[model samples]
Target: MSPRVRGEEQPGFFEVLGTWLPRQPWFRAPRGRLSLTRVGGLRLPTPAGDSDSRVFLELHIFEVAHQDGPVRISVPVALRSRPSAIAGKSAFIGKLTSPEHGELWVYDGAGDRAFLAAWIEMSRREQGSRNGRSRGRAHAGFAFGSPWTLELRRTGADAPKEGVTRSIVRREHADSQGEHDRDEIVMDLLRRPAGEQDELLESLITLSEANCEVIPKVLGTIDGAWKQKDDADDAGYWVSGILGVIREAGISGPDGTSIMRRALQAGDDLSDSARAAGRAVGTFHADLAGSFGAHPQTQEQLRIMTANVQSTLTQQWEQVRSEFDDDEAADLNEVIDLMRMQLRDADEPLMLQQIHGDLGAEHLHRTAGDAWVIREPEGLMSHALGLRDVVTVLISAADAVMSVAAETPEILRAAAEQEAAEAEQEGQSDAPAEPVNFGQWYEEFTQAFLSGYRESDADSAGVDSVFFRAAMLTEALDLFRRWRGQWVFRPSMLLQVDN
Candidate 1:
């Protein structure tokens, strides 16, 4: 066994993580040096009958102090005797030289198969044990369903023999017809543990219980407790929730590639797919509402939401106004004024319900049976306008189409010439016109999505067009502000069709 150093004696592990954590995509540290202190953690034993004794699995929670504030980060690490080629260099955290273990290879356990296998085994073993009970305290235990790995490995014939009649059975039967059928599972590690108040696990349970087939099934979850620095109790006092696991039935691919990009690349019409996605989202929303219940927004709530939107509009305009020229500025100002007017006119009471806070085309995936399944529904809002989710989807679809259009040779050349001309003229004119087909494509997608949404939940379909338009404009301006002076495209181009 590798020597486990405690407190100030563990310089190698802490130093390596301090340098590596900031470079990660999920690490949300501010733009400066960070002071990382190990707050709390748990170590899990390897799976039964495993011969690799040198490999150790641990979930460590660190209190990362930056300029802003302290952020708790949960890092699941797999310490191995040698470098892991399968986990690849991307998952490699850094080499740790331990006195007893010599050179140990440290990797992010979220990507390591061994770590995953061990985690699943632990959860399964602890399912009915004393650690599995929910005590309404910090030390609530494991909650899980049937093991997804075993289910995935089962053949259709075997399932029927066992009288199993699930959607997964149908999915497996379809997979048996193809030679490329492989078992893949996707796990989400909460970088910032939210303790028992974590909405993701609750949302997953709600959706799963309601038979919401549009999402991945909840396989298992490990809820652990850790001690914070400010805890007044003992050292090992359980204080936080740790990890969640879900079974991913869809085929995996590159993260940046969305369904829209795939459709465009294959030159396939996405109207049908868009409609299906819309229906899936609608069903998801309906299920969420049925589980959590929806309420009509109060006048005060409406007033506050409108004020926030207007404030965002003003702030974004102030930040990006310098990027636009005289003509472009006037056009943008017109859009902002229209948005304000629409906000004022949008006084109709809307239903406030649990919503998928960050819905986009990228989060939508197709399973082996070509059914749409939504992934990464982590950002669940307890009470928000369902239109917010719809608007986000619409904007994402438009952005996808715009991205494809921008890549075409004609549009690229036009953009280049326009940029050169604008430089020469000192940003005096408007942006170049969009491609002729761009508006049509965006319109087709929008209509198909709304149609699907309406078909699923007619009551939620009474969306105020003026409010939707205002929300779209607000989202576009927010995107522009986030782009941070990248003048490749203007927000005006996005709203030209609507205008």
Candidate 2:
């Protein structure tokens, strides 16, 4: 057996990290030199009282500086006695000799099975603190808040996503004898360090505490911080937390975008689905307002919204025009001019609220159990005009419907030609094709979605039609740029300016 290394006798950990940090996907600095500083980290409980057990789990925070600026990242470090004991080949960090522990194998904690289980346990217990010798100091650190209040019933193994984050599933069994069970826990870890508390996620957690249906239940939050700038030693950087994964009865169903695309492809009626999505969004907004409270739509807020819309629209027009022919560009310019004029007329004040700033078909999910869940608060506008969410959803849906419809005819024409060619080869008749009534479906979906939104508890009476139309134009322009980049849009999307 080897003598254990005292805190002061430990090897230069950052020396080895300098070589390994660049290999991670979350390492954002351009391929060049990096200067590192140990900020802070937390310790996870390891097996106790086993002389042969030499495994340790530690999260290390480092401030990496490059030409641009300094970026903070959290690296979960796993120390093991042997290379063979490392969980995976990809998890390997570097091998180093410790004065007291002898030789040790280092691995990224995210990939280690023991680390994942330990993290779940720590989060469940709300245990947090700093550990290990950093910056010539030897002391154990503790988390900022009280013990975690939420409990996950069960946790399933999960793999890290990309190199940035990882997820663990919590399952709940069915009460009925023959009914199936489903996952309820969704633990998320941000590989890099966060500057402060995430207000949006915090709001969701609060709503979950209140038993809100739209937002996912926040089981618990785990964060690691280190003293950085202040003279007083304080926990600073936020690391990770656990959330209840929003799913329809354990089934993470397809998003609204995929569902709408399916209906458009099959020429099926999309009214019911679109209405349900709109209602879900409305319910989500209502819950947010009820939990966070709404703000009055001040004149300044209206101006900011309008100005932002104009600025985005103007920028997007440049990109959109580059992709169109001269005639199409001229037509688009005229539409842009009209939209700018409409923006000038948006003078009325309306109610504002915290909103899902990135609401779209893709950001929402519908389950087979007839439930809708807001997947994530990807973009949050704490004081946005409440109508912005409604307008954004409408514009996104309209753009999608129009873009798909416009392309379908050409696609059908090409398919028919291919079928004819095949038929000629076999000397047989071509198969009859089913016609898609895109306009009819579009109208139905548009009306139903808007109706559903208007019917929900979210305040909508003050939504000025002129403001709505202007926002729709701005959103349409951005969508045009996106569709053009993807080589999907015709002039039809631009025609939306007339509305």
Candidate 3:
């Protein structure tokens, strides 16, 4: 049966959503009265002989008006006869009194198991079935001849288990995370629907097709076209590209702590795990290159990169000159000059390939079996220097180390003061100990990471030190601009590019 829209038949559907939509963390809009117009939607069918047959699963697309422009937001809703105990309070939307269905309880479908199952099933059907059709009402002057079309693809070989529980994991990022059945599958619902250039889905599909084992296994993808609010017919004129994705969840440690957090707690013992992560990343890069094909660095690309680096350095210098004294300014200038020289002298052959645009410790996790699993490959660039990813990871590692090391001086000072007081009371004198070299740890970590990277990929003969140093300098300047005093001298110390 074709999906139907019962919003008109059900009373208070829009009113209920207006009150609930703004409060959601996924909803990207100003917290005020929003002019929400229903643009398009789909009501997915539930499984046969389901426990909760009365539940209605729906995915609604609404165009919200703002000062800047109109933004389309997708809200997957589950309407039940009564409030669900499993969904909890966080997933609950406002209750509505439907004249057709009586008193109904609404919940965010992303968190509901029924909705997820239906979504996965629909995606799976698209993989095997040829007669699957997306049908909706038609009107005059429609650009497309057919009704809305859903193009869902299942990438993973294994099917999700039945009766799996669902839970939503909220992160700082724009997308929404939904975990199924205790780390079985992690679904990321892409909140902002990009029309055609869906980098995340495209990257996943490419990697999955290539059988990249380092990344999380992609299970399925949901993408399609939907009718616009002003469209004459139900034939979709607007593309809702890559709505959501399902992938296997990364295996965490025995204590359930993330690899990044573990590194922060024990920086000295980070060599092995750091090396494993680096090797995994190297393998990931290799797979990406193999899938998408790599190319030699071009002169035009180099020129553009150099210009961007120069612009960023100049801007950062202008922003931070007033914050430092003459000596500090001289040191900064020296570093900037050194970076410029490195960029100019970078003549070595480098390979350009699709890169993980944002690779950090947070995206890496070590399993209980000591294998490293990479996550969140959403920030992907089709063409970029692979060293960019390496530089990003190194910068992230530096920040993690410095954040803890920043408090060491004050802690040591307090300890020394306490010791001196005790000694004075006892009529004894003690010499101060040598200061700890925190930078040495970061240096060791960097070497280990690079070593692992080299060990993993033979194609990566060696990293161009000049370009690496230059990238680090540019990253440092950018960090300093954002963090100001907190990051003023730390980057220089941790980077040690001069050495």
**Candidate 2 residue pairs in clash (backbone atoms < 3 Å):** 3-100, 4-100, 5-100, 5-101, 128-143, 129-141, 130-141
Models, CA RMSD each: 11.4, 8.4, 10.1
lDDT of 1 by residue, 1-499 (tens): 4455332234488778878887776677567666777766667655543344677777777777767667777888888778877677877988877565577778887766566665665654553224542111111122333332312221111111121111212123334533232234444556676566756666776676666777765545666555665544645545756454434445242222377776554345678877887887888888888878998889998788778878877786777788666887887788778778877777777788888888887777765545577765546887787888888878777677666754666655766586668766885566554444555566777788888888786246335555666667667766655644332234334533221
Error of 1 at 175 (Å): 4.8
Best by TM-score: 3
Q: Which runs of model 1 end up more than 4 angstroms from their true locations?
A: 1-40, 48-56, 60-112, 125-182, 190-196, 231-237, 247-257, 261-267, 297-349, 375-378, 406-436, 464-499
Which residue runs of candidate 2 sit more than 4 Å off their true CA positions? 1-12, 29-35, 47-53, 68-70, 82-86, 97-103, 130-163, 168-185, 230-253, 295-349, 367-370, 375-379, 409-433, 462-499
Better of 2 and 3 by TM-score: 3
**How many clashes (backbone atoms < 3 Å, residues ≥3 apart in a chain or on different chains) does model 1 have?**
1
Give the alpha carbon lDDT tens digit for every residue of 1-499 in model 2: 4343322125867767788887776677655766777766666766343232777777767777766666767787777777743266778888888656778778777666556556655755445454422211101111222222122232323323432454443322334321132233454556665555667666766666666665445555565556565334755533343221222222245677787877776667877777777777787778888888887777887798779878877876776677666886787688678768877786867777888887777767776555567766544788776667777676667667767766776766776677678888999875745656655565578678778777778887544455665566556666666655443233233332221
Better of 1 and 2 by lDDT: 1
Per-residue lDDT tens digits of candidate 3, residues 1-499?
Answer: 3334365357787787888877665566664687777766667776554455578887777778877677777778888878877666777887878555677888887766667666665554543222222332111111122211221111122212221222322222223322323224456555555566856666766776666777766656666445564434545555556566655556322211244444444333567866777788899889888888898767877677777767776676777777666887888788777777776776665778887888877667666456677765536787777888788888887776656555665756765677678888988877554444556766777787888888776256335466666667667666655654555554334532221
Candidate 2's displacement at residue 150, Å, is 20
lDDT value for model 3: 0.62
RMSD from true fold, candidate 2? 8.4
The TM-score measured for candidate 2 stands at: 0.67
